[model samples]
Target: MSGEFNLIEKYFVDQQAQRSDVVLAAGDDCALVSAPVGSLIAISTDTLVAGTHFLASANPRWVAHKALASNISDLAAMGATPAWVSFALTMPEIDEIWLAPFCEGFFALADQYGLQLIGGDTTKGPLSLTLTVQGLVPQGEALLRSGAQVGDGIYVTGLLGDSQAGLDVILDKSNATKPFASELEKRHYLSTPRTQVGEALRGIASAAIDISDGVISDLGHILKRSGVGAQVEVEQLPLSQPLLEFVGSSPQAQQYALTSGEEYELCFTVPDSREDAMWQALQDIDCQITRIGTINDDDKLRLTLDGQDLAWQLSGYDHFKTN
Candidate 1:
């Protein structure tokens, strides 16, 4: 095999990987994907650089997982059912020691969602991973940020600020206990996108977004698109047992709860009328969900912690700002 083809075939492609909709797989010049009639395709692309997204020495397996999961989170936000993906890897050089575990992580996560890796590219350059994910949502039924109403309740699946707490552990291992630190590290490296919750929330959630950035900032997307505002009760934001232990009850923890990002939980809005149905649907799923705020008539987004006003400042990761 040619050098490029050898690398791709060895680490990425699974010739035995089965998908009826995939007319052509990785060896082709272009991949041909088919969707069921009447279903809409949802496509999302994400790129993670070595130093920016992960430490250069970080586990290649985790690096692969994060790249794909982040894009999958985007599809989940739109209530799309994941189907296929195309990967592009740019690396300083070929090293099977890194490549082997990387593909292992990629395929493991793909199997969980029944996602197919149909095609991708491999090139020598700065170390980076880019994944393009595609999913199918029924026609006219995909959830959107513009669907939120003024009285809708703002709800989030899973805990918040764990990823940032994880980043803390990454930056300073001495800051936390070994076990607790491991928990935080796991959150930083592996974020489980709420794919099932998003799919289940269709027609139930008024608006939906994934908590990649801080909730306050991400909710702003829903507010801007839905042309409405929200009032968040900061004290009500959920934190995991590990996260609570990591920072304790303090302003610092509070800030982490409100501002840290990359949790990948689904932040959704549900109308009062659908509240019962939402509860009923969620009961069958094995996850945590919480209502932290409510939509409003005012155009301003505000927050209250322990019934006192909390200032809104310091948004989540902005590529331009971070740069």
Candidate 2:
């Protein structure tokens, strides 16, 4: 360990640093946590680099917000209520002008979810941010990808591919300011983690996952983990009004919508018998839940469009792909 400001010492290492359920924290040697007797812990981490995750020139405040929201989405998948988070920021230099607004955006969402920032580290390096978030659920009640079963109905929250549509606009900059383009851009920047929706889904969803690496790929995680297959109806895949207007009904746009990354909507599976109640519950909260597909016992993932089977051109976004 280098002697330069120890992260544990400056930020984590002391009883005075305790924020919530962190019974013991950094400084000594180990961190201790306490959970309510009937509660389970849900933890997740996400990292965003300047050039990799967002444009190098992206606003610092939005960057901070996305970094936290992405990790919070994981907790949502587990149907957990967020509790705390620790941030690790590595930047080339310290700029108060940037950090101030960044912290404001970060804390604003954290406060909204009642999450406490317990500890974190700041270092000199390229612009990168990582957040480790924790949440709580009733013991043995956390949702899991492995819980999905055949014959389950597939559902997705909100729309898909709006973020990808916004990204395309930013990259090409071809179109003049259009209403759809503006909405897509805003959705790409200000995605809300479905914490309330997730919590409401507890005991209802058989399996769940957040769409981070596009719908096709993220859904594959659920199918693979649950040892089940799924057949999605391309026509039923929910596309935001902005996305439909921006991309139109072109084949290429449909491919991108199916494979583009950074869509943070929740995809879940529920039994048909429970569909009515589930939809009612989510609708009560004003969340638009769309049925896009159904689970299958066959070991093949398939897609259908307008009552006809169609081969998907792409399996979904992969970070390693040259495309």
Candidate 3:
């Protein structure tokens, strides 16, 4: 069995992404990063356990991708520019085949965002992955869940419920056929962070959050923090065609869109005054933005379908209540 130091040198050090802000990377007691002037550092951490987050039989490559993507998604929600990441891998044993592809996937996404792998650790334990990522945002401009206000328009970036459908396919619960099944699984494993769109929303969005838990659950955070309520139009949910086909009913698909977790899309609110400007700013970003609801002063979330009141009994992922 290869030792921890040996594995770090072979798989974690000297990654492809290089950042000028990273003064010292890997092989040190603590990594050093230079904070940009007039900028605030935003940091987030996520942990993926073998059975809790992904199947043990999952591909190492996608596992690495999901681990890194989840953490970066938090940074994106804060309207931050990704700059550095530190990873920690705990596994019962190391397989060279798994190590090679895992490193490949981790560095690939890091390089795409110009993230430097500053430091991390490899240890003997149950199979799990943890990552801490840091990003920079202009002082006083970081997006937060408490910034929302009554009468703001609620919007979501990209389609929802696809990741949950993908999970169903992975676990053999989906009846979806080929092409569609593959597409669903891809969306599950390879979630986009929406960093660019989040940055674009910095000044425009009144409040924002990344949808890791279902949209209802994550958006609830924004509402609770801002002391506001929301009226969501069920018919307006951004459900993808593949998800609709997989579930075989518009209503069922919307249910999944509302309650399924791990979507990683952004749910944001924009003041009525900034609505037009928000659209104009996000035009160049390669993401689909949909208006799905409105913030209100009632301090409760209300669901409606086709102008009729809709009752929602379902909830999103809760670490304690789920599984």
Candidate 4:
């Protein structure tokens, strides 16, 4: 075994070797698990590559937090409670300082959500991290994109476009030492996956998805899967005060709000009749839910800006596009 693999096996894998619920764990070709009867399994995987998902010189702690949080967002989209996660990290070299802070941030967030790090793999390669998260829900009760119907009210949690704003600052480099830089940087680094809000939406939302690929694009998934369309008011898009100040109400800013990725908020559809109740439920959980638009029978996605309907020149973030 290599030195890094030996380190992981000794410090991490061996420590988790005795968990009773871990049917199969480390030191194996593949991990296995036995799910309880009547419970459904939810699994999600996400990969973060240096210089793509994050900068090559990005803080290791935040990189680790984001790697785990992104997968947790998938669990939230299905209204599942996170149970366990396994990480696969590829790095050119093992830096103890980087690994320590990275693990600290990773474990802190995992512990906050009651998730256990069961097992993982480490290897020598370019810096990349992948996390596979498993969650559980009652059988047949998982929320799906196919549940949306016409006349369903569209709701989103928190504000949009802050992460994009943060990304701009990071890329510019000139803004790094500015006063608002810290706040903008936090938006990109410390994404809060809506796990609690998603759990609270179990019986309330008709359909749900996380806003990882920007609102218009992510909502397109629900529309396509549900075989419905929507009419959204651009003004109703919740923008953070910082984002407002940063972009200054420009048409360009509006486009970024619609297309920026990595916001990690929840966009869901609920019946109009359940609107009040859903709002109350969200409030009780201390989550902010904004009613942004409504699903429509017409098979067209429409956006209204200042009482005038306009065609979107673009949808949302596309991985292959230069954007």
Q: Which candidate leads the pack in lDDT?
A: 3
Report how far residue 104 has shifted in candidate 3, in Å. Answer: 0.9
Question: Please, what is the whole-model Cα lDDT of each candidate in the order they appear?
Answer: 0.83, 0.78, 0.87, 0.81
Descending-TM-score candidate ranking: 3, 1, 4, 2
Best TM-score goes to which candidate?
Answer: 3
For candidate 1, lDDT tens digit of each residue in 139-250? 9879898999989999998888888888887777687674488888888889998888988898899999998778888899999999998999988888777877788765
Q: For candidate 4, what is the lDDT? A: 0.81
Better by TM-score, candidate 4 or 2: 4
| Displacement of the residue 53 alpha carbon in candidate 4, Å | 0.6
**Model 3 poorest ten-residue lDDT run:** 314-323
Please identify which of the two predictions, 1 or 2, would achieve the higher TM-score against the true structure.
1
Give candidate 2 misplaced runs (Cα > 4 Å). 1-33, 175-179, 250-253, 318-323
The TM-score values for the models, in the order shown, are 0.94, 0.88, 0.95, 0.91
| Segments in model 1 whose C-alpha atoms lie over 4 Å from true places | 1-5, 176-179, 318-323
- Report the C-alpha displacement of residue 129, candidate 1, in angstroms: 0.8
Q: Cα RMSD (Å) per model?
A: 2.2, 3.5, 2.2, 2.7
Model 3's alpha-carbon lDDT is 0.87
In model 3, where do residues sit more than 4 Å from their true spots?
1-5, 173-179, 318-323
What tens digits encode model 4's per-residue C-alpha lDDT throughout 80-165? 98887888888888777778778878877887776777777789999888889998878877889889999999988878888877
Greater lDDT among 2 and 4 belongs to: 4
Kindly state the number of residue pairs that clash in model 4. Answer: 0
Candidate 1: TM-score? 0.94
In the predicted model 3, the residue pairs found to clash are none
